[model samples]
Target chain A: MDKVILAKDVSLSYDSNQTIIKQATFSIESGSFVFVTGASGSGKSTLLKSLYGAIKPKQGSLIVGGVELNNVSKSKLNFLRRHLGIVFQDYKLIKEWTIEKNITMPLLINGYEKEVTLNQAESLLKHVRLKHQAGKYPMELSGGEQQRVAMARALSHNPILILADEPTGNLDEYSSQLIWNLLEGANTQLKTTVIVVTHHIPSTLNVDYKHYHIEYGEISEIN
Target chain B: MKSIKNHLSLIVALISILFSIQVFIVVERSIDAYKENLAKNYSVVVVSEKRIANSEFLSIDGLINRVEELSPDNIINRLNTGMDQKNINLLKLTLPKFYKLYLTKFPTPKEITTLRKNLFSNPSISKIEDFSNNHDITYKLLVLFKGVILVFAIVVSIVTMLLILKELRIWQFKHSERMSIMGLFGAPTWLRSAVLFRLSIVDAIISSILIYLIFMYISTNRFVLQQFDNINIKVVIFDTLNDFFLLLGVSLVLSILLATMIVLGHKEEV
Candidate 1:
């Protein structure tokens, strides 16, 4: 399988004095479900950010979806990001927009036709079981429902890669399970590479997955 | 309610700017019309030692529109006290030539001086009465008024533009979260800030319409017409089609440009 992400001795830092991820080397294969686990401040979020070109690798190469991310231009970063879906812990939905409109955001950004985007949004709203609340704003939705909306949005564009940073960190057990099921479904059905950053992997997750743990600024795969 | 307040701020700023521009245009047009009226009636009295040809007057300055000889018949007739025809004819022959020089436009004080100098360059020309004392005061007052209006317009425009920028920045701050959310989803800059642009553009249109209605009413008001009539000057207060379109264009451009600046200066949160 082709590698969706490749990092060779990649070092990341917000400033020069402190390095977060130190000389990390890894490659994620296409269509693989991967979990990155680390304690607080272990640079898990920072590493996840690097995958989407939000945080550039301070040293060495980092490639995502066949595009080199080191020293990438803003337009090139934006282009790369368009093909990637990202779910945040806080569920970064536009509060003013309706949940249905939020689901259509990715499609709209991809220049999908309005009718097609709306139809896709409708189907996704049903899939997320929020069809009854389509017109409701994000603020009106519960935390779990909002995350589900965020999940529906991430999967809406059929992106090549999906990055989730503690997607269910604050959700209840049922909501967390629902988010996991959605992630797994996308992985098996769509053949999308999934990289998730979390402190713990749920024991109930049934999919065959790879695990990478971070400690003392070092990232290593666990068999 | 908050959104309406935001819209109101931008609309108010745009109205001030457009009002200043319209006032400037009206003042300029009024001054031009007044100058035209004055030019028709104003003339320079030139006394010459001998008959000066019309061609010679034209050669003095390009501003000289026409020259008409002031026939000495009236004064000579008033002086005729039972004089014989020969003596009267001799008196008329010896009289110095008086010519009224009309200019194409109202002469500024500097232009009046230049005309005086040019006329005096001819030794045969003896005296020039340009009525500078009154002309200078009127011209100076008009110039002062124009200068004051221009400065006022510029100051108002600058201050209002700054306020517009500030209001837009405040709007951006309110929408920044939404914009950054869209940005994280790979929305283009223009698409992410589409709301700001749309809001500003709508306000611009509203302001333009308000200014148009206000000016339209003032232009047709009996009091305004009577004031112009009292001053014996005809001024075009507004050109409905041309001025409306111009104000609309200015408001749109300014709002768009300011909104763009805010967007470009925004710091993406993600």
Candidate 2:
């Protein structure tokens, strides 16, 4: 399989004095379901941030979808980001916008026509089982529903890869299961590369997935 | 109610600033009109040994315009209590020749002095009354009035601008999260700031229209008209199309400039 994300001896840190990810190297294959699991403050989120260009790696090369993220220009980074979907733990939906509009955000950013974006949002709302809640604002939705809306937004533009950081961390078990199924569906049916950063992965997942564990600022894949 | 609360300070600031500007403009125009009216009714009286020809007075620089030869017949008539026709005619001939010289516009005190100098330079002229003291006092008062209005307008504008910028910064802080999220999703700077720009433009239009209606009503007010009539001066309080476009431009530019500052501040924070 072709690699969609490749990090070679990448080092990341918020402050120059304390390194988070120290010379860690990894690669994620395209069209694969991958989970990055680690303890709290073990640099799991930092690695994800580097992949999205939110934070540049201090050393070595990190490429996402064939674009090097180290010292990347803002415009080029935004261009690369358009092709990727990101799901935040807090949902991060625009509070002033309705669920439908929230889901259409990525499409709008990608310059999709109004009719096309509206239709896409409608379809995604149905897919997420929030068609009834489409007109409601983010604050009006429950945590579970808002997460689902964020998931729909992540999948709206049919991104090449979806990077989710603890998407189900705050959801109930039922919502968690639903979100996992959706992520699984995106990986299996849509063949999108899915990389999720979480502290725990459910053992009951009934699909093939690669697991990478981070310990002491080092990452290694486990069976 | 919430919308009003959110924008009240901004609207008030805009209105106050714009009102000051309009008052400044109208007062300036009114003063100019008053000066012109005074110029029409004011003139210099010159006494000469021989009757001065209107053409001779016109020959002096800045002294040309309307010159009238005054007849000494009025003084002679007042003195003719019981005089005969021959003595009355003799009294009129003995009176000095007086002429009034009108200028095209109000002359400054220095210019008045120059005119007096030019008049006195003629050997035939004996006395010139240019009302230097009155002209000096009036000119000084006019300058002082305009200066006060200008200073007031400038102070109000600067205060209003600072208030506007501070308010915009608050709005930026309020919307920062949403803007950051949009940025993460690859939205361009313009797209992320669309809401800010829209809010500013809408407020600008609203304020501009409000000022227009206010000035329009004041322009036709009886009291305002009475004041101008008292001075025999006609001043256009406001020109609808011209003033509207000017206010709109000012409001729009100010809002946009303040908004741009806030937007650029956000970029620096990131």
Candidate 3:
């Protein structure tokens, strides 16, 4: 299978004095479900950030979807991000916009026709079981519902890859299970490559997923 | 309520700036019109040793628009106390030639001096009376009034613009979170800040309309017309088509340019 992300000896740091990820090398294959687990300060989020072109790799080449991310131009990075879906822990939805509009954001950015974008957003809202709350703003929804809306948004564009950062960290058990099921469905049904950065992997997840643990600023695969 | 306050701040600033600009234009036009009226009524009386043609006065100074000989018949008739016609004719022949020189514009003190010197350069011109003292006071007052209005307009515009910028920056901060969220989703800069641009543009249009209405009322008001009439001067305070379009264009350009500045500055900080 072709590799969707290839990082060769990548290092990350916020400043020159301290390095977060030290010369880590990894490659994620297409259509593979992967989990990255680490301690609280083990730079798991930092690694994920490099994948999405949020932060540049300090040492080596970090390639995502066949584009080199190290020193990537802003326009080029934005173009790459348009093809990828990203989920944050806080569920960064524009509170002023309706949930339906939030879901349609990615499609609109990709320059989809208005009618097509609205129809797809409606379909995704139904898929997330939030069809009743389509017109409601993000502030009006519960935390779990907001995350679910975020998940729906991630899947709205049918992205080739989804990078989720602690998607269900603050959710209830029921919401957590629902999120896990959605991730599994996207992985198995849609055949999208999924890389999630979390502290713990849920034991009830049934899908076969590769796991990578970060320790001491180094990433190593676990059998 | 908050949105209204924001819009209000921008609209008020735009109105003040546009009002200052309009006042400056009106003051400038009024001064020009007043100067033209003064030029029409004022003239220099020149006494020449010889009979100088009107063409000679034109060659003396570019300021001389027209020249007319002052007919001596009136003075001759007034002095005649049953005098003979032969003596009256001799008196007319010996009397110096008097001509009135009309200027193209109301002359400043410096211009009057230059014209005086130029007229005296011709040996035939014996005496020239420019009435500089009265002209000097009127010209000085007009200059002072124009200068004061110009400075006031400039100061008001600058201060109002700074306030507008501050308000716009606050607006940028308020929308930064939403903008950053859209930015993460790969939306372009223009798309992300579309709300800011829209608000500013709407305020610009609103301000333009308000100024147009205000000026239209002032231009047609009986009191304003009475004041201009009392001064015996005609000034075009507002031109319905030209001034309206000019203010609208200025407001739109200013708002857009300021909003772009805030957007670019926010981007750099991020």
Candidate 4:
């Protein structure tokens, strides 16, 4: 019904050296599963960072769920992050804490009490098929298993939008298909807007998703 | 907020150390003071080469007349014949020597040891005049302890900060990502600081409990406080508490400063 994420004339650069995506613009609608594909260093991760307010755009504006990203207040940024589910390229789960604890992190940050968070985490662990590894740390789990935990952690707070840097970059075919199924489940069950960034486009991703490509500092939606 | 639960272990650790150290210093000082008082009183009756026995061999009228005629500040305590004064030659003790007397409700082993040292090789003094109206060994102990506690607090504070700082040094480079997650977790600045403050308070409580138990145990023993009556025990216990608070207060303050510095400094990137 409304734009879940939007960027107008957005540009990002480091040290005034070079601008990667100049005058780039796009809007992601709610309840959409979008795949972002690009060659190496096409600013896909940078775009996601901008959406989560981790990086301030050098020019123009980026809005997530109607809140401005450029020079936004920290309180508002925190509130924005509360509703956002971001997965890093390396599946940034804390190594010391267990899988369940990692999954409950966002909710814990959002100030949900222990019992509520625990119940939700338990359910999410079951949903992700990591129920047996609830108490296992991230390092103990395989790459695919860790990715699943990351995805579950991203989805734990019931966030409106999930931005995954690379959902299945290093996973096996079985794990990749499992990740896709989990993504599809969230999209259908919770109507969550999901944006997945990847350099690979396996032939198996057929969930009625929109496709976008990043090339030569520009973005375009594929027909 | 999540870090609070995480840091509870550290808090408990800090509290335990502080509690033990506090109790140790208190008991140590108490023992030293008790011995000192005993030694002071022993210095009077024990025949020693270091001190001259000021026995009043003259008649009562003469002794009284001479003592009264002397300086008004001089105080004389009359010795009864029933005391264990037999075979104790007061005249052989070193004469014309000043003795620091601590009149306590109980005998102190430290005072005894020290007075024994001073009077060990010399004759014992019999008749005595108390020139200084200084308080008992317990009071002197409390006063001296006020400084010792301050120093101990400073040492403990420095040690705790250095330990935390050292751990943080490793965490900064190796576990910075973890720190960022904690910062991003919506835990308040004060709450983060409370991690360290909680440790200090924990330390204080543990130290207080330990010191109190130790005092109750050691002071209750008739052997430990052989010189003091029950009333004196109560007074010493009451006064030791005063000493404990003074130390605890300093330790809390030091911990607060260190915890704030470390938490704030570590919150940001390197």
DockQ for all candidate structures vs. native: 0.64, 0.66, 0.53, 0.19
Candidate 3 local Cα displacement, residue A129, angstroms: 3.4
> What DockQ would you assign to candidate 3?
0.53
Candidates 2 and 4 compared by lDDT, better number: 2
Model 2 chain A lowest lDDT segment of ten: A199-208
Clashing pairs in 2: none
- Per-residue C-alpha lDDT of model 1 across residues A25-120, encoded as one tens digit per residue: 999999999999999999999999889887888998999998999988878888888999999988989877889999999999999999999999
| CAPRI level of candidate 2 | medium
Tens digit of per-residue lDDT, candidate 1, span B1-270: 646776898899899999999999999988888888889889999999999999999999999999999999999999999999999999988999999999999998888988999999999899999998988888898899999999999999899978977887787787888888888878888898888899889998999999989998999999999988887898878788999999999999998988888887888884
Stretches of candidate 3 off by over 4 Å are: B1-8, B193-203, B268-270
lDDT of 2 by residue, A1-223 (tens): 8999999999999999999988988888999999999999999888888888888899999999999998788889889889889999888898878899999999999999999999999998888888999889998989999999999999999999999999999899887887898898889999999999998898777679999998989899999
- The best candidate in terms of DockQ: 2
Candidate 2 lDDT tens digits, B1-270: 545765666677778778888998998998899888878888998999887777778887464578988888778777779999988877777788999889888888878878888888898899988887888898899989989989998998898778877787777786677788888888888988888788788888899999999999999999999999998899888889888898889888887886687678785222
True interface contacts reproduced, per candidate: 0.73, 0.61, 0.52, 0.18
- Worst ten in a row by lDDT for model 3 chain B: B261-270
Residue A154 shift from truth in candidate 4, angstroms: 1.1
lDDT assessment of candidate 1: 0.91
Q: Which rank order by TM-score, best down to worst?
A: 2, 3, 1, 4
Q: How many residue-pair clashes does candidate 3 contain?
A: 0
What TM-score, computed on C-alpha atoms, does each candidate reach?
A: 0.89, 0.94, 0.91, 0.66
